[model samples]
Target: MSAAIKRYGLGILAIAVTFIVFVVPLLFMALIAMKDRREANRLEFSWPTNFSLVENFQEVLSARKFMLVTAFINSTILTVVSVAILVILAAMVAWVLQRRRSRWNPTINFLILSGLIIPPAVIPTIWVLQGLGLFKTLTGLIFIEVAFGLSFCVLLFRAFISSIPKELDEAAVIDGCGPIRLFFRVVFPLLKSVIVTVIVVQSVSIFNTFQNPLYFLPGDSNATVQLTLFNFQSQFTTAYNLLFMNILLITIPPLFMYLFFNRQIVAGMTAGAVKG
Candidate 1:
């Protein structure tokens, strides 16, 4: 009876904490977004007497001739392209690094680890992009995101690969399957869970990324979803209602993704853990 009560009590405490920490702020933001300009500007947690959610939504969409729409498209393209490359490339590299033992493996492993530890130098990266004639282009930004995300994805892939049976590789090779086909057909299908994990994680991060886009892919034409926030912000004045509305809109996608795929994320994260 005492243990049961303690368990119930702990659960209740966790629920209360979650409500206070996450739900409160989300509710507050929604309330503000639904409010009119004057009420939202107050930044109070109180309910608004005038709810103008539709009006604010329309205004935000039409702002700067639908820059938000453009930003959304750009962000989608960026996320899709970057994550696709990261998954395929990372998975292949991880497979090779796991299956093949070579003298150069240590050096290559060091570089991958270094990528996770070292901060990317923006100026040098920009210089290289410019030299390659990819600066200020979507292609350049795509490469930047892929490069930054590669190490983490590779590490996850390598860890998971270690647990896979080596017999699968040997059988595929004996059946006269090439390396590319073996990976694509045999291993890639098995990576669905981790792939979902990587895609969702990287997609959210890339979509929410502001600094890299701002620094590397500058200009209104190349604006991303995050940069759309600047539309409601300025030196002297800020459109609080519209800003909150924008925030509400931009935050919805990633929130829904996590809600739906949270299980897969946990499973993938714990995939290579010790069983004993």
Candidate 2:
């Protein structure tokens, strides 16, 4: 009875901490987002006397000829393409790396893992992009996103792949299916849960990423949803209310995605915990 009580207490404490840390800040931000400039300038979490939520959203959406819409489209394209390519490539590579036994496998595995630890070299990357004539292009940004996210995706897929039975592969091979058909038709289908988790998580990440887009894919036309935050901010005076409103709008998609796919995320993460 005492141990159960202690566990309940710890759970309650964790919930309280999460509420204080995440929920409180979000509520404050939402409150500020509904305030007018005067109340926003005060930066208080108190209830607003004058609501300006619609006005703020309108201003943010209409700013600079509706650049936020453009940013949203750009972010969507980057995320979809990047995550799609990353998922396919990462899954294939992970399967090969995990299934194929060779001395060089360790070296290749080390290099893939190293990507997670290594910081990107901005100048060198810029030079390469320029050489490839992809600088300041959406294609360039997609490649950057895919490359940066590859290592982590590979790790997840490999872990999940380990949980799969080797007999499935053997069975498919014996049935006269080529390796390509075996994986796509046989192995890939079973990876649905993890793949959904990866898509949801990485799509959110790629959509929200700012620094890579800023560096590798500059210009107003190529801006992402995160860069749209700058529309409400400036050097002289920031429109705090509009900025907060913009933040709220941009945050909704990913937040809803997580809420919807959270169970899948948890299941996929634990899929390979016990290796067969």
Top candidate (lDDT): 1
Model 2, C-alpha of 209: deviation from truth (Å) = 0.3
Q: Model 2: which ten-residue window has the lowest total lDDT?
A: 267-276
Clashes by residue pair, model 1: none
Worst 10 residues of 1 by lDDT: 267-276
Candidate 2 local lDDT, 1-276, one digit each (tens): 999999999999999999999899899889999999988999987999999989888888989889999999998889999999998999999899878779999898899889999999999999999999999999988899999999999888999999898999999999999989998999899998889989998999998998998899888888889988888778999888989999999999999999999999998787787882
lDDT of 1 by residue, 1-276 (tens): 999999999999999999999999899999999999988999999989998999999999989989999999999999999999999999999999999989999999999999999999999999999999999999999999999999999998888888899899999999999999999999999998899999999999998999999999999989999999999989999989999999999999999999999999998888777631
Clashes per candidate (backbone, < 3 Å) = 0, 0
RMSD of each: 1.6, 1.1
TM-scores of the models, in the order given: 0.95, 0.97
